[model samples]
Target: MEWLQPTSENLIEGYDEPQGKLDIDRVESKQITTNTIISDFFVMLNCLGERTVSQLPAPDDKVYHRIMEEIAPYFERILIIKINNQIIEVSLQHVKKEALTILNNKAVHPVLDEFFHGEADKSGYNLFGQVPNRSVYKVLPHFIDPLEDPEVQQLFDFLKEMCSVTKDFGFILKPWLLSDELKQLQAIRFAAHYCQDVYLWVDNDTERIFEIQFKF
Candidate 1:
């Protein structure tokens, strides 16, 4: 999924806080519902808000594509899903060592949390960059395309507002988790390309999320 900015130049329409976020329980089902997806996204945005998060401030075509290209090669771990399911501890072992050494751990963990545990660190590193308060970074446009349902749109609005209340600047590692079909684990390696503090995520498919152990 393209994490499109909610900028006027990009179709010009649309789109946080460090506070307690909403948590909805997962209802077991092989086929995920739209509401479930919406809730998962809401939690992701709220997680971004609760910390000093970073996102791409609507990057121009060149930078976005280049960064994506650079990120493409980082995902090489063949996650035998059925096999990995039994492992209790989830680590960045799946992520390439060089990327982790380059971008460092801070830039990648949040994205990992979203993909694996379906949560974020409410109390992780608070080191923010030199972004001025109320800069363009604070404005996060909707990442996904406009949906057809009014209820879903309203929920999305709630997500937009959630980010508005936080100290979020454009420095996040975007993972294309808009659908279950996307290779989400591979997609999240997008974090490895950047060497700064970044935060990002999208609606999840609720793949029976497991417990996540904190490194810090």
Candidate 2:
């Protein structure tokens, strides 16, 4: 983390650890698998109905059954970590593929590209999430009480069992400006629309008010 003078783009002025660079693949291209995450912008690899046994590499039945009686069901995906001398990541797959395309193509964004696997957080060494309707939780939340849903409760137990195997693992999302502090900021304001260009309406608007929109 470092601090500097605020710019039009970054009003907050300071940043947290410039995010974790835990993998060379993420650095080169913010993609773990070459598969498509699709429009939902959710679900790690789009394994909508796939089970852990199908998605994960084969392990001993004794090891697998101990984790979950029949087979462990993921919220959608799992973070498989195998820790040795240093952390080793094993799971991060995007399940969906573009079937309509004549050419193999994929799409990504703030949503689909977003993976909250907190590999950097000590508590989140093996990231697990059950995000419903886009709500988020801490890297790790205490599951002290029994959940109402039997399947969900089972999933929680499954997550705990997975954590016991500390040897192996793995899994981000990104953002830019959100606010500004200047008094005149709101008075004379223009902000980008998400992934949309700030100067998008510049050439079209009669008032030309969008001229002040961000350029760089």
Highest lDDT, which number?
Answer: 1
Model 1 Cα lDDT, one tens digit per residue, 1-216: 243222222211233221343332221212211223333332333233334211222123443332223322232321211122221111111233443344433333333344433323332322232223211111112332222434434433332332332323232322222333332342222322211222332222322112111110
In model 1, where do residues sit more than 4 Å from their true spots? 1-34, 50-112, 115-123, 131-184, 189-216
TM-score of each: 0.19, 0.23
lDDT of 2 by residue, 58-110 (tens): 23344443322222222223444332322333343333343223112444332
Q: What TM-score does candidate 1 get on C-alpha atoms?
A: 0.19
Predictions in order: lDDT:
0.28, 0.26
Quality of model 2 by C-alpha lDDT: 0.26
| Regions more than 4 Å wrong, model 2 | 1-60, 63-92, 98-147, 167-216
> For model 2, how many clashes?
13
Error of model 1, residue 79, in angstroms:
42
